[model samples]
Target: MTTLLNVTLTPDQRDLLEVIAAPWLARGEWPLWANVQHHFDMRGEDADAIFHSLPRVGTQTPFGAGYGFTLPMRAPVDGKDRVRLTVAASLVVPKVRPVGEQFVQALQHMIHLYTSRPMHFDQVPTIILRSEELEEALPDLPVWFFDVLPDLLSNEPTIITGGVHTSRRAWEREVTRSVLQYRRVQSVEGYIEKTCEIVVAAAAQYGPAIAVAATVAAEPERSPYIDAGLLAELETAAATNRWKVHKLIALCQGLNDAYIAENPYACAAMIRSILDHIPPVFGHTDFKHVAAQHVFSMKRNDKTHAQRLAAFKDIADDVMHRPIGHTTPRISMDDLPEPIRLNAILNEVVIVMPKSAPPTT
Candidate 1:
């Protein structure tokens, strides 16, 4: 009397899984079986199917895809975040004589093939989403923003014409909106410097034109938050329009997209940095078992920040034109009806920025 969990796969995911199952699914062997509940369209029984069909697209990249509508995945691990005890226990259902790390490695490899990449395991980690905390993460940010972050991580096609610059900047803004609200590193100076480095390196590596535009916009320094030297490097990289991700990754090698994905704004980065700096153990998040791979792709602010600003503004403007749904929009900090609006107004949209104390002298 064991309960089986049924998981659904998208057409693409199903096709991908078929490729991985090939090894185990050789001739003369019994068909591979999955733990699917014996029922037709029972609500929770189709959890796997529903998760795959989510409106937002998911990436099958070696590095795990973040953002987009993700189904909650939980498992009990040894440290801070553990896969669920029950789910982890399910792996033994097949009753292998020696079910251990080797078995686990096999399963992971199978997953990698299905994903179509030899992504570094260290880089790609299974992230569990916290339904409650994620709600808070969306605070003034729109939910749709999450769906687009994965797109930014992918390499754009070679055929698109020159306007990739405009689109690339737009993507940066959307990415910024999604992560700027999350936790990040403590120092803003260290953050922007690293971002510009990544963008420039991306450009020099023959990244798309939009990618180059993102690097160009991030190429110079005006505000104190950025590093001038990194800006110079980006400018030099710009001349050739070629970048190397590995080389540039060294700049802000450690920053998380949630922590350093956007321009350095004392106000925006305030709460996010606090979150990024905290050890995950003490932090409040739905992802109990998170791997060490943190950070997202991002851009830095410079004097040319004007174009960067407008790109993001256009995105925000576009969002304004869409239909509002069951949930009230987030962009309107003021729409926060009396109770919520009261505090926002009092603080002047500064969620974490503290007001300066008068006359400290």
Candidate 2:
């Protein structure tokens, strides 16, 4: 029988589904009620209610006492959210029958393979038979059965397997090899745990100051003094060794904020601080050494840019050490170092720094 189902969800529910469904959607697999329960942190009955509320397609295996259901899920594609259908099959077994741990592990392994790569097809076929006997005794079922089976399957019983289209066979083979050999963080939970540890460590190290600066830096407005792309490169380089560059990133953020606010004195001081902070990245003890000795090969005007930056140090010193007098001193936006000079130094830093190496298996 054919059926059409439509589900309407609240904005919050849709957002939650977007997160819970991402990995399953990426693999073109429908999440079972148990998967939904884990992600949503809901009780079994509630998860079942929600799962059944969504649209589904149902079928039974021709050769075995197996039945399955497929669900339609939403995911973002080409910058727009779209709904796609996914298939999954399971056997009907007596409640007294105990599923083996080996079977459970094989299913998990297959899922890990599917999720570790980018989406290859709009739908992946899946079949979960009852036992090895059932899989071995299987006959050639109708074409529709192949249409509903998964691409990557564990061969060892309880056997899971699927047929792939000719176009996808090559990709499937490569994916299988790479995923089996190089995959790290075996499960989704392990990956999440590692990510949380990194975040917590960063929070403890940078404290609230860097966090606040990051928030300010994320604003849409471009800073007149700092090139955002160059700053991002510096941030990436620093991320490899955060203790060395946390202050530098914060200084850049403060400088950008000061320039946007037209606080010329603050801008001068921050620029001076940044010049003082980044010399070590270039293997120099001080900014003066960086300015005088560091070779700039990208452009002919780089020496002149370095000279201008060196001059700004003196200007900033005047702003910082000039004693308060009966007559107040004046500093204007024009007095700040030219952006080109600072950008030249930043570009050199990005070019000189070693990038973080890719993680190894």
Candidate 3:
């Protein structure tokens, strides 16, 4: 399974990237080649030589428009999905590697090089693995990390594989520290090195679990728990709403998790939440107006989209908008209707954004 992630940065981090990327950006280099020879300090490069030396799908450099570049490591695009890295204003990495463990290893490598502080998060600053794609890939995400942290950091004075370890405490500390540093301008000591240590440690400790999660995520039994079709729809929605990656990620995570857990009430709650969230992103307040205006570009009728959303809203209202004193009974799995229609509605919102085109001064 290929995963695309957009790393949201703090203003200071953005400034740092601007400074590092200034010379190239000034030269009209949108999708600059990743300087393979010197990965960390990318000043000038011999593009041809770097491309030849680096690990990739082929000799051909990835064709794209961006200010950053792909990492120089060899990519695994066979059997496993390929892991492609594009570093720019946003450190966008699409895991295309064939093997899930390989992808996690690549993720660890790029993540280490990217930052010590947990810059990649949802809305929060902690090193929260905030991608629905990731959740699908790693169902027991937090547990998996804790399980794998010890062996990865085995060289340290205190460490254990498949057992409780201090690395868990260390990992938590790094997240908290990163959150503070991200929110504030203050710098912490050994932030980058410590981050690398923590990440690598976790990766090593949970190597087996990571591989299993990746495999399960990549190839799940035919069940509503893992919907490949819905995954595709969500991915399309994600790419369209790239600018609002954080919000999209949060929403996607909520929707996917609810479905996987088979909780109709939670799914309904997500549907309503998505309905409320869509308006502001598209520069509209009334969802009915949005539907009447034919906001989605997927060639569906406004009336149809409007009605489906209305139905979704009604279904969600039981859990989402019940009165404070009203005792609403919990919805049972057997009583729950799968939210395929709501998923389509949310995806349609992504499709129609560019077409709607909010007014400019």
Per-residue lDDT of model 1, residues 91-182, tens digit only: 22232112222222222322333345345756753322222333354444334322322232232111011211234223211111222221
What candidate 3 gets wrong by more than 4 Å, as runs, is: 1-242, 295-305, 323-330, 333-338, 356-361
Q: Give the per-residue lDDT of model 3 (tens digit) for 1-361.
A: 1112222333433333344344332332322323222332354432232332222111122221111223322111111222222221123122211122332332443244236554555675534332333434556444443333332333221111122333433321122222232222112112222323333344445331111112212432112322334445555655654334456557767776876677777766766676776774456786665666644543432345456676656667777667667664767654443333454555555555545544454
Residue lDDT tens for model 2, 182-281: 1354442332233233333434453321111111123222234676666777778756653356677788889989987889999999999988877776
> What TM value does model 3 have?
0.32
Best by lDDT: 2
How close is every model to the real structure, measured as TM-score? 0.16, 0.37, 0.32
What are the lDDT figures for the candidates, one per model?
0.25, 0.46, 0.39
RMSD of 1: 25.9
- Name the candidate that leads on TM-score: 2
lDDT for residue 85 in candidate 2, whole number 0-100: 25
- Candidate numbers sorted by lDDT from highest down: 2, 3, 1
**Of the pair 2 and 3, which is ahead by TM-score?**
2
Question: Residue 90 of model 1: what lDDT?
Answer: 19
